[model samples]
Target: MNTVSQTLGQAPSAHVYKNDVRRKLLLIVVFFILTVLAVITDLLCGSGTLPWHVALNGVFHPDQASPMVHVVMWDLRMPVTITAVLSGIGLAIAGSLMQTVLDNPLAEPFTLGISSAAGFGAALVIVFQTSLVSFLPVDYLLTANAFIFSLVTVLFIGIFAARKGLSVEMIVMLGIAVHFIFSALLGLAQYVANVDQLQSLVFWMMGSLQKSTWTQVGINAVIIVLVVPILLLLSWQISALRGFGEQAQVLGISVARLRMLLLTFSALLASAITATIGVVGFIGLVAPHVARMLVGEDQRFAQLMTMIVGALIMTLSSIVSKMLIPGVILPIGMVTSLLGVPFFVWLVFGRSMGRR
Candidate 1:
C-alpha cells in the first residue's frame, strides 16, 4: 500500500514538472518573437523613416536599391540596431551572473562600478588623447582604455572577494567604493577638459549608438557568443548554487572557484559592451528580475529569457529615443535611465516590505 502511494505521489510531481517546463518554453518563444518584432520596428523608425517595403528591399538587395537607401539602411541604421541587441544581451547576462554568484538581488555591472570605470577610461582618452595600446588606431583609443580599466577594476574586486572569503555585503560595499572613486576621477577629467573634449566626454558618457561601426559590432558579437555558451554549460551548477547557497559545497561544487570564474566572465561581458557603447545603464539590473518573474530561478531558462528581455527593452528604448524628439535623437542611456529609475524604486520598496 505504501509503495502504491509513493508511486502516485511521484507521478503527480513528474507531471507537474513537465507542465512547468512546457510553460517556460512557451514564454521563451513568445518573448523571442516579441524581440524580433522590436528589432524590426527599430530598423524602420529612424530619423528618415523608411517604409517597411523599402527597408526590406534595401536589406535584401542593397545593390538594386537606390544609393541613398542603401547607405541609410546599411551604413547608418543596421550597425546601431545590431549593436543595441548585442549590448543588451551582454549586459543582461553579466548582471544575471553577478547576482547569482554574489547571491545579491541588487548586484549588476552598472550598480557595482564597472560601467563607471569604463566611462572614466573613455574620459581619460578624450581628455588626454592617450592610448594604453600603442598599436591601436587613434579612433580605438577610447575603447581600449575603457576595456582595460573596467577589467582591472573587476579583477581587483574579484581577487579581494576570493582571497578574503568576503560576504555579499562586503562585496557590495567594495563595489560602491570603486564606483565613487571612478566618478570623482571622471569629474576631475571633465573639469580639466576643453570645450570640445568636454562635449565629447559628456556625449560618450550618455551612451549613444551614433558612433557604432561594423567592427565594434563584430567584436561585441564574438565575445557575447563565446561567453554565453560557456555560461550555459555551467548553468546546472549555477542553479544549484542559487538554490542551495553555501550548502552547494556539500554537492562537490567549489563555491570560491565557481564564483571567481563567473565574476571574470561577467566582467568580460560588461566591459566589452561598455567599451563599445559607452555607459548604458540598468538593462542589466532590470532584465534578470523580469526573467525570474517569468521563469523562476533555473539558470538554464532564466539566462536565456534574460537575454531576450534585455534585447527587447533596449530595442524599444532605441525606438523611443528616436521618436521622443522631432528632429533630435536623444541619447539611449537617458531613455533607459528614465525607464529604470522608477522600476528600481519599486524593487527596493517591494523587497523591504517583503522582509517585513
Candidate 2:
C-alpha cells in the first residue's frame, strides 16, 4: 500500500497538462498551414489556359495578366473558392452543433432535414421559374424562396420538439419526416420541369461553384458574418451541454433555447450554401468528427478546427474536381461525396479499431 501510494503520487500531473497544451497548439498550427495551402493550391491549379505564375500575379496586378487568367482567377475561381470555403465552414459548424444537440455521432445538416427542405424549395422555384420572373429576379427568386422553405423545415422540427421541451428523438424524427415530404415534393417538381429548368436544377442539385458571382458571394458573406458570431457566442454553452438531455437541463442550460438558436443558424447557413453552390455532401458529417478526433471535443478546439479542416477539404476537392477532366468541370458535390463516402466508411469501421 505504501509503494502503490508513492507510485500514484508521481503520476506526472504538470507534465500531462503541458503535453496537452503543446499538442493543442500543434494542431492549431497544422490546421492553419493546411488551410493556407488549400487556398494557394486553389488559386494556382485549374484547367485555365494560363499558368500558375500568371494567376498569382492576376490577384494584385490584373492589368499585366492575360484576360483569360484575369477572368478565371478573379471572376470565376475566386468567388467559387470563397463560396466553397465559407460553405464548408458553415456546414462543419452545423454538423458539430447537431452532433452535440442530438447526442448522436452521426447528426449532420442534411440528416437534420435542412438540405432536403432547401432542395424542395429550389425545385419548386425551378419548376415555376418561368412564371415567377415577373414577381422577382430569376436568380434572386430561386435563392430567396429556397431559403424560406428550408427555414420552414427547421421551424417544424424546433417547434415540435420545443413544445415537449425538445426531445432529441422528437427533433430527429421531425427532421426525418421533413426529409421524406420534401423529397417527394422535389421529385414531383422535377417531373414537371422544362428542359432548361431541369438542366439547371439538376446541375444545382449536383452542386457546383461554376456559377459563382460577386452578388451571390456578397449576400452569403453578409449572412455568414451575421450568423457565425451568434454561433460562436454559444460555443461554451454547447460544450457544457454536450451531456445528455436531462443532465444538460440539470446543468442549468436551456436545452430548447440552445437547440433552437443553433438550428436556426444552421438552417440559415445550409440555405445560403445550397442557394449558392447546391449541397456539398458529407462536409457537415465528416468535418466535425475529424476535428474532434484530432484536437478533442472542446467546442473552442472543435469549432476552430472544424472550420479550418472544412475549408481545406473544400478548396482542395474543388481543385481536384476541375483538374480531373482537364477541360471539363465536374460538380463539387460529386467530388465531396466521392471523397467523403470512403472517409466515412473508414471513420465508422476502421477508426474504432485504431482508437482501441
Candidate 3:
C-alpha cells in the first residue's frame, strides 16, 4: 500500500517534468524557425532588394537567374550570411565553454582579451604592412598575424593560470590584465598609423562581413562542422562540470584536464572567427546566457540552442546593419553592440534581482 501510494505521488511530478521538457523542445523548434527566417531575411534584405522567390531561386539555381543577380546572391550575400551563421555558432559555443569552465558569468573571448589580441595583430598588419615581412598578400598577413597573436594570448593565460593553480579569480584577473595590455598596444598602433592605415585598422576593429568571401566562409564552416560534434558528444560532461564543480573531481571527471581541453577548444574557435572576421562582439557573451534561460542547465540542449541563438542574432544584426541606413552599411560589430548592451544590462539586473 505504501509503495502504491508513493508511485502515485511520483507520477504527477514525472508528468510535470515531461511537460516541461516538451515545452523546452517546443521552444527550440521556435528558435530554429526564427533562425531560418533570420537567414532568409539576410539574403533578401541587402543593399539591393530582390524578390523572395528570386532570391531563393538565385541561391539554389543561380544559372537560371540573371548574371548580376546570380553574382550578387551567390558571391556576396551567400558568403556573408554563411559566415555570420558560422561565426555566431562558433563564438557562442566558445563563450558557453568559457563560462562553464571558468565559472564566470562574464567569461567570453572579448573579456579574456582574445579578441583584443587579435585586434592588435590585425592593427600591426594594417598600420605597417610594408615593414612586417610583406611576402604574403595583405589579407593572408592579417589573418596569420591575428591567429598567431590570439593563440599567443591564450598560451600566456594558460601558463599564468597553471602557475596560479587555475583558480577562477586568477584566470579572470589575468584575462582582464591581458585585455588592457592589448588595448594599449592597439591604441599605440592607431597613434602611429597613417590616415588610410588608421581608417582600415579602426574599421577592421569595428568588424564587418563586407569582406566575406567564399573561401573564408568555407574554411570557417569546415572548422565549425569538425568541432561541433565533439562538443556535443561531451555535452553531458560539461554540464556535470558546471553543476558539480569541485565535486566533479571526486566523481572522477578529471576537472583540471577537462577545463584545459575545453578552454583550448573554445579559444581555438574564438580565435579562428576573430582572425577572419575581425571582432563581432556581444553574441558570445549574450547568446549562452539566453540559451541557458531557455534550455536550463543541460549542456546538450544549451549547446544546440546557443548555436541557433547565436546564428539568429548575427543574421539579424547583419540585416539591421544594412537597413539602418539605406545606402550605408554599418559595421556588424557596431550593430551587435548597440543591440547587445541593452539586453546584457537587462540580463545582469534581472539576475541580480533573482528573476532568472
Candidate 4:
C-alpha cells in the first residue's frame, strides 16, 4: 500500500488550489452578473413600465424625470430592490451558518421553528390587533411582535442549550422543540380568527415585499454588513468543523462556543429580516446548497456565493410576484417556494444519484 499511501499523503499543489479558486471566482462573477441583471429588470418592469434608459435616468438624474417617474423609481422600486438584496443576503448567510453549525443540511430558521415563531407573533397581531398591543400603531404592531417572538425563541434555545454548554445536537433539538410549540400557537391563532383577520394573517405569512421601505432596507443592510464580514473572518474555523468535527475541539477551537455564537448571529439576522419582509422561506436553504455545488464546502467562498444566489432568487421572486398579476402583486413567498422547492429536490436526490 506504499503507492496508495503516497497518493493520499500528497496534498494538492498550491497551483491547483489557486486554479480551483479562480474557477469558483469566475462562477461567482457570473452569478453576480445575473443578480445585477435581475435587479435592473426588477427596476424596469414594474406596473408603470419605465423604459430602461428612463429608469436609469430616473435613478441617476431624478430631477430630469417627471415627478411620477421619480416617485416610482426612487421611492417604490429602489426600496424593494434594496430590501430584496438585503433580505436575500441575510437569509442566505444565516442559512449557511445554521447548516454548518448544526451539521444539518436541512437546518434553517424555518426548519428549526424560528420563522414559525416569528410568523406566530405576526399572526397574533393580525388576529388580535389592538387587543394585545394597543399602544403601538397598526403598522408597527405586527413587525414588533414578530421580532420579539423570534428573538424569544432564539433566547429560549440558546439559554437552555447553553446550560449544557451548547452541544450541536442539544441546540438543534431545542430549535425543533421551539418550532413545534410556535407552530401549534400559530395554528391556534388561525383557528380563533375571523375570516378577514384570517385572510390578513395568511397573506402576511405568505410573505410580501409590498411593505418594503428605505428604513427597513437600511436597517437590514447595516446588520448584514456587520455580521457577514465577522463570519467571513471565522471562515477557516467554521469550515474546519465540517471535516475535522471533534478534532477542532482537540485543536483548541472550542467548537461548542463557536457554534453558539454563530447560531445566535444567524438567528438574529434571519429573525430581523423575517420581521420586516414576512416569512420568505427557502432562499436561506437553497442558496447555500446551490453555492456549495458551484464552489466546494469552503465557507468563505460558499458563504459569499450563498449571498449572491439568495439575492438572485429573492429578486427573481419579486419580479415574478409583480409580473404574475397585472396590477395585483402576488406574495413573494409563494414565488420563492415555487422556485426553491424544485431546486431543493434537485439538491437532495441529485447528490444521492451522483454518489451512485
Best by lDDT: 1
Give model 3's clash tally. Answer: 0
TM-score of 1: 0.96
On lDDT, who's better, 2 or 3? 3
Model 1, residue 4: what's the lDDT? 75
Which tens-of-lDDT digit does each residue in 74-186 have in candidate 3? 88999989998999998898898889878888777666789889988898788866324357776688877887788779867876687669688888888889999999998
Model 4: lDDT of residue 297: 92
Residue 25 lDDT, candidate 4, scale 0-100: 93
User: For candidate 1, lDDT tens digit of each residue in 256-332?
Assistant: 88888989998999999899888888899999999999998999999999999999999999999999987788999
Q: Please give the clash total of every predicted structure, in order.
A: 0, 1, 0, 1
Query: Clash number for model 1?
Result: 0
Off by over 4 Å in 3: 1-8, 12-14, 130-136
lDDT of 3 at 250: 77
Weakest ten-residue segment in model 2 by summed lDDT: 128-137
Stronger candidate by lDDT (1 vs 3): 1
| TM-scores for every candidate against the unseen true structure | 0.96, 0.91, 0.94, 0.91
Model 2: residues with Cα > 4 Å off, grouped in runs: 1-15, 63-68, 130-135, 350-356
Which pairs of residues clash in candidate 4, taking residues 3 or more apart in a chain or in different chains?
113-179
